[model samples]
Target: MTERRIVSIWLPRLAIENWQRRNADWPEDLPLALATAGTHGQIVHDLNRAAMESGVSKMSRIVDMKTICPALKISDADHIGDTKWLARLALWARRWGPWSTPDGTDGLLIDTSGADHLFGGEPAMLIDIQDRFASAGCSTRLAIAPTRGAAWGLARFGSERAISKTDPLPYVAPLPVAALRLDPQTLLLLRRLGIRTISDLVAVPRLALMRRFGRANLAENPLLRLDQMLGRRPEPMASPEPPPRYLVETRLADPVMDPSDWLPGMIKDLCDQLAAQAQGCRQLRLSIFRVDGVGCDVTARTAAPTREAGHLLRLFDGKLENIDPGFGFDVFRLTAEAVEPLNAAQPGLDGEDTEGLALARLIDRLTARFGADAISRPLSYESHIPERSQILGAPVSDAPAPLARADRPLRLLTPPEEIRVLYAIPEGPPGAFIWRHQTLRVAKHAGPERIAPEWWHDRSGTRLRDYFRIEDPTGLRLWIYREGLIHDGRGAAPRWFLHGIFA
Candidate 1:
């Protein structure tokens, strides 16, 4: 197997760095500490180098840290949000490679393997990554090696060693066994046994090490890690996740409290950006983030895939008024949630447009006022049953479907209505029918049209139907059907049903 090169970017103060990004006025050298709830009380989760140097360290009690450093800065830790920020950075780092993952809340691991040459070489790439985080006010420790385990340890402890694949053992052996990423108890046990460094640990036989330490962990756990770090064992990584796009965001210079003050312009700005990125998308989401860390969001979908800013704004006009911006909001983001290909429109020479397009826009507005399910359209389906052949589809655009054409009633009873009938001839056309408490006499009529039940489905209770178009005395035409055949093998008697009436 080919050797792999992994780069570890460690942010020792990830939560503090995230907080600093939000508040730009924070001093670079200020002593800052972040705390999280513990069984006893708030405990320090992370701290800046300034705080660490001032005799306040991580895991120290919040009150104790404050007492130690009178002018220290402290805040509560948002671990989830901090991790998300780290993941986002890792996603953005994909310009280098396709494999990037979160190491922890405070770090990221990137497999730059064959991609380093694009930015010059491995050394240049390392310097570039360091410069980016440094410029962004993110304190970082970057190290690159042939394995993730070694890269991780080097980033935390090694000082820009620039070690090669063949020289790993020599450089790594001198560091304490903690660089091997062992449990504290194991490290303590090894220290008592006069094995404090990787060199001392490797001096013992692999079989003896396995037998001695196997009970605490896997039989080859320590040896396996050493092998993995030295590139002797294979360590496959998970595939990198793709970054989300069709999104645009704008942060305000000043927070806007009232909806009227900022919504329209912000919507127009973000919609224009979305139109560029999401040319054939149907659904879009708008996010309003307040300065106080609360967010309000809304979604809009077009009847067809469209990128028109005017049409999108029209859909959002009334809905934007409903969002309450408590205190004030400072950031606006728009993302295309869904999309599809759309055919180009071809109007008539006389400037007449297709009714389908106009109808779609009308449905778009109506659904914006109502909801998605409130507006529907007829979609043809391939089915033998008459009523089951067509379905109610969303107003979204799709390819047209072919349907069977036959002389049928304008309206149909869901289940054909049973009615009293008088036939002109036995086992023939209906002379008259009484339906819904009304008596009608046939003046003229059309002959029987036979339709059989679908054989593919259940045929137990189904029978052949003979339909007729009959005109009543008042000139009203009624569609009627007779179920069951006259001389078929079925034992049930023939019955009449009122199917529908023609306009």
Candidate 2:
């Protein structure tokens, strides 16, 4: 197997250069420092060349930095934005290698194994990388070696930009212990023990060093870093995984006035991709790019998640009529915006779910003809009151579960109608009632199910209700409820209400 060659790129003035790139109007000759809130106050996080030349160092208080450089420009540091920008820059660096990753907040690490020959040799590759970054308005120090640790150390501290592929310890031994990436606390302890550089630390007995600093922490132990730098330990390069994208595009050989013929093929390609992943799309967008530098898009939404080409193609009917297609279109692209997992299922022998599939297609067609908000269905809600138990929502949403009680009325009134009890037994169901200016004689009755108000939502005057199923002489059954009990002190007299009717 070929030895792995890693490249480490250090951006010493990344934060400063990034800000300057965004604010081009600022004078480059004036000193500038990026400040971040610290325990004492705003502290200097990073500075440009002019600020460093003026003797303003990192971590210096902003108030003190102003005294040193009277014309210094101070601005709040965007740490998060800088980190994101560095990640993007590292991804952009992958043109020369198979993988690249951000190395701290201001550096990048690229694994360039077996890739240098394509751009000449290792030296040429490093020069190309340096020139490219310089052209992009960035200051970079780059080095390549057989090990990540050695490359990292040489890029930041050593004079050489390329180390020998056979051995890297000779070049790494002269660098300072800080190049080992040890913490400040460990560096301070090493300094007190008269250890200043990698050579000095290597001279000490391994047992003595192990006794003083255990091998528990890989990051803080100098021996571990030494082993890694000398190729004794393995360091794998890990790159960030980009987000999944479901998009396909076609480039026409010549500009055409109409893109209608190209859309089906593009949509089929997109659906095939989704099918390969066992996924389906609920929303899609078709975009046409004109040769005149103009672009237009039309979106389609489905009643349910589907990857069927025929169903999806019909949804775009009459959608592209308004597009001007000025000059001509040279490209067509389709993208799936919303996706969901769709596993395959065996069809029943009797073809049971065909009706359901047809209903969903009908809803999708109606929605395409009208608008998204025009098609809706009722979904059951978790509530005790009949009027608050169902709500209207998108037709494709989950169907409401069956009611637990079979005695529920087929349809409920929006606002229950008040009724007068013409005659009734004391504390019992009414024998006769007058509703909507008509008297109804009751024959049979079922229940007086008592229901209590929701204490968390109801006001003080709210009272309990007693519901009953009453059948009149004409065989018409009504759901009736008493609003309050007699002498309950919540209201004057108990009132009766016609709440619903049976099927």
Candidate 3:
């Protein structure tokens, strides 16, 4: 097999170029720069040829940039939108090769080892790539060599539109040492040592270079990059990862009036297709398209990844009626929105679904009716404080079902109500109190159970509470508390409050 030849493309002004392509009638005389929020201050992220010619460069302070070019136009960076444009460009580049990966730093790497012949010759291929981008109104540079490292170096450093494969070390020897992609600190040290070019570094013995740089990091990256360009070390071209897509649509010959009869069968069919594409899908969205040209979506999510047809049908039950099919729904689409990998279930004899799995389906139905955040489940938290221990979270899992604590009330009030105490000691619990415009006498009372806040969590404004189980006249058990310890001589005088009621 022949060695793979890589082609590296550099679009140093991609951010501004993409903006110019999308928006027409941009001022040609004014300098443009894209700015993004930085730790120090708003810094110049990407500048155009006009901005650079005005002595404004990338990383230049926004303040100084205005001084250099008063008419300099700076705009917020739309990184995501720019990347999408690059993705479209990548699809266009794929006609030349099967594999292409985004360099993520204003460049793209394409494996064109055996693809040059498709365009007749190497020179023709380079011209075609240039012409394509030129037609799109974007300027670019291209280079090809035996190794990716060599192609990257030549593309960025060599003064040529394209450089054919040659002795890599000699070809890159005269290029600036920055072509090696070394960090700024390392490059500064090398410059201080009078090693300003690749040729100068090649003259220095490897053992001597190791003794100087190997101490900081055992793997000498500068030497390794040089070796890869010289074909001494292997550097493989990595392809871009494709995003996961899951969608299936089905059209019926006749619109259905009764959803229960037709929707179940259609849902089962869509689930089969979705299972084939992605079985480990956690969130699913079902879109119902009506004959009246109206559409509505019903979404459901499971605690864990699932793709069972029966479970999916049950989860989406009654959801089809929500679309209000006036003329009836003629099309149904099931899509996997959020996904996670899960082990394939072992095929077994047909039987009913497990009870444990049913909990997830129940939660799914509840979430479909009420919004996902509308419902919550309680769990026994690690905190000792009664209120803090009752941890409430969304109904997304069944591992921690709501468990009632006998010591704590089932329904806890958000803000404890202050009862008008008719009589009580100066530094003691309430003997009797006025509640709900009715005086209720205390039949019996439990001893004071003192509970303090988690000291590690908060050391400020946290007072210890003394709780008491008091029985009212109507046999109603009330959980009351007095704020702060009387003996500690800390905090305000004790106040009584009704926290919860235990029936």
Candidate with the greatest TM-score versus the true structure:
1
Ranking by TM-score: 1, 2, 3
Model 1 regions lying over 4 Å from their true place: 25-31, 161-163, 218-220, 240-385, 388-503
398-462: candidate 2 lDDT, tens digit per residue: 44334545686868887999999999867667999999899998898988888888787789899
lDDT tens readout by residue for model 1, 1-503: 54578888888867877887787787867898888997789888888778988999888788998999988887888888887788677754555565788886788888888878977888898887777667556778888888877887788778763545655787677778777777777777878989877888789988998787666553236777787777888766664645335665665767787544454565566556555554565787776765544566688887677665667778876777667776676667666777665455568888976776677678788888888777666677766556677787745434243353556665678787898875456756666667888877888788688878887874676788888888877888777888887667675678888877677
- List clashing residue pairs in candidate 1: none
In angstroms, give how far residue 216 of model 2 lies from its true place: 8.2
Candidate 3 lDDT over 74-145, as tens digits, reads: 888889987877766664465556578777658888887777997877778878777767756667888888
Give all candidates' CA lDDT scores. Answer: 0.73, 0.83, 0.74
Listing every candidate in turn, what is its Cα RMSD in Å to the true structure after a full C-alpha superposition?
A: 8.5, 8.9, 12.3
What C-alpha root-mean-square deviation, in Å, does candidate 3 show against the real structure?
Answer: 12.3
| Model 2 CA deviation exceeding 4 Å by range | 1-9, 35-45, 50-103, 108-137, 142-151, 158-176, 184-205, 215-220, 228-270, 281-305, 308-341, 344-415, 419-503
lDDT of 2 at 461: 90
lDDT of 2 at 310: 86
Deviation in Å, model 2, residue 151 alpha carbon:
5.3
